[model samples]
Target: MTVPTPQAPRHVRAVAVQPHWSARDFTTPDAFRRWMRAQLEMARPHLRPGGVNLVVLTELNGLPLVLRGGGWALRLRTFERVALALFLARLPRALPVLLRERVSPIRALQLADIDANTELYLRTCRELARESGVYLCCGSAPMPRYARQGTVLRRAPGVLTNQTVLLDPQGNLIGVTDKVHLTPDEEAGGVDLTPGDLNELRVFPTPAGDLGVAISLDAFRADVIGSLAAQGCTVLLQPDANGAPWTSQEGLPPDPARVRDQPVAWLESSWQVTAQRQIPYAVNPMVVGNLLDLTFDGQSAITGPAEQAPSLRSYVLTDPRPGFLALAPWVTEGTPDELRQAGLDRAAHSGHPLENEYREDTLHADLTLPPATRPAPPRTPHEDALDALLRGEARAPRPGTWRAALPALPLLALPLLALALLRRRP
Candidate 1:
């Protein structure tokens, strides 16, 4: 076995894939193969001889093998959770499993799928990496923490975890970054994912430069991105999945203006990290016509460095629909440890950052969708309550404050009563 050596950062092309989705994509195992094949074909041309291919979040959830119909309310989010609880309620051979696992039935079934097909995704990624000759960031999916068995990766049963696996050109597993944040939809029944240690960020050696990987909300976090850049990463790959909300425009509402345009949090988050860190950040989000009740739609893009205040102004490769590869036009030119030695990390404290000076002013990619009004993301119950309270649609004061006001209300009224008595006497 030969030890891989670091190469000087050269100009390279990177593609972010926006996967195509449909009910078939998640309905059966066979559909998964078909959908994934299409995705590979779209990404093949952009893989280039040496570069990166980023597949966005929950790529495997597309295999909704168990839950089918009912969009957000009926199937994907709520009812499926209830279904999980019911399925586990009467299982005869699950006492030991219960001790080690607390994931939903949906999550459990997905894990089972992985166990039955050990090393399937990993092997596929290895093949893709070797064939494409570019580093591949195989975004997230549900599985137990992996342990290799011979040439296969065997996952222990009931060990719940999901990760972003990185593959080199030779099909080697160089890094694994697990997800960092969970929306309320994921933790509905008081269950959540095992968060990866932010400190354990893997920096893969490549001619393209030292690359770091972040999953979903991990890219949004200031500390996380800065720490990776501080660790000397020239580029960051973030695979995200925050679905498009249910914005029903049927039978148009009397006040269409009430429907606010919702900007994607992860997209906006990508802009902040790229411009601030002065590094190329590739982000890919999952998109679908509609899943059961969930509607997933968004673009995939590479948000790289720029010189002006609008740092990512023209340096963005955005693919909003019909899955395509988002690529950068020019290769980044830099030395070994170019990003680390730049001392741009110190700029977080000072007002100046060194990396922003190098800009890719020329546009490189052609795959794109014109900008449109993004619907507001669906709010969690907590968010809904907060919004209602703020808008005076609900009155839910704290128990302590309400209780405190009870006695005070009567006491305050006594002054009014006394004043009325005095005025009558006068």
Candidate 2:
């Protein structure tokens, strides 16, 4: 009798696709499809046959589709021109919707193109998922509520949302999740978006595990991830697009005594989740490159449960942390000093053709999902300390005495002091 060899159990093999956005890729529906297909193709090689393969993309990856058919204006290389072109082209139909919905012309223009954009976005995702035979998170895009009428998708009367969709290998929609937390920029100005309800957060079950999609900023919120984990979500997908320098400060950072880099603060997100929620697996894909005046950059990473050997592709990090399985290579090639000299921290765009910002890449990791009935990992000391600190702060009494005003006396007297000095000088 011949001895039979036993095969290892199938597990989740995921890829965080780091795509560099370019206006040219979204010039037309065909172009957009090609770009999306290319991204999936890059990740396809890493997937194992007959296993769960998941592809994660960043937030706003599809928002550029709003500029479809503005190929003539792309050469101008300004979002203003593209928006003007699209606005003029859709004015006839958009004007009526703007009047009816009482929305800003900026938003109305996006709405006018919603149906086509949504249809193309859905079709491209479906085709890619089916062709690649992998589960796909189609990233987040600004979209209005829509109804499917047979083969067509029709826009309904609703506010636009930053929404993401997950699809199965068979090209079926598995789940949809909208960003519940909006950045200040997203909530203010013309982009005023509707936030998703926390109560209705969706968790989709898969062979890998129960998966939760938390788009960008939503992933940082404890309540959001906690709700998903409570509902048996074992894996978290955080699609991000930080529209600023990755090395810049995240709005003054968390410490007033010292400075903190934005990307380092961002690392706290996925790492914090695995430590807190006991959701052992998480993927964060970031969209890089520039579009008009806006620039997006970040290092894409796949985080696992515990410490592992870091990949060579990790952003020559200043502070290396555990739990990161893999990280996409940095967009610019240089040492910290060389990069700083190259204006890596500045807003100026480097026109170098060979820069990694113009290229698309993928970071892959093979993760074994915990069993369905697995218990939550024990809390770490760091988490316990944090919890205790939060409790102590909550119980601390707020100062109501005149001593509270002492700290602000100098600030309050600054204007008066300046006025007296100016008067005396005159």
TM-score of each predicted structure versus truth: 0.58, 0.78
In the range 102-151, model 1's lDDT, one tens digit per residue, is 44434443443444332345555566666666666666665455443333
RMSD of each: 20.6, 15.2
Candidate 2: tens digits of C-alpha lDDT, residues 171-270: 7666678899988657735355678889878677776567898888888888898888887887899999887767555555466657565766786677
Least accurate stretch of 10 residues (summed lDDT) in model 2?
391-400
- Name every residue pair that clashes in candidate 2: none
Report clashes for each candidate as comma-separated counts: 11, 0
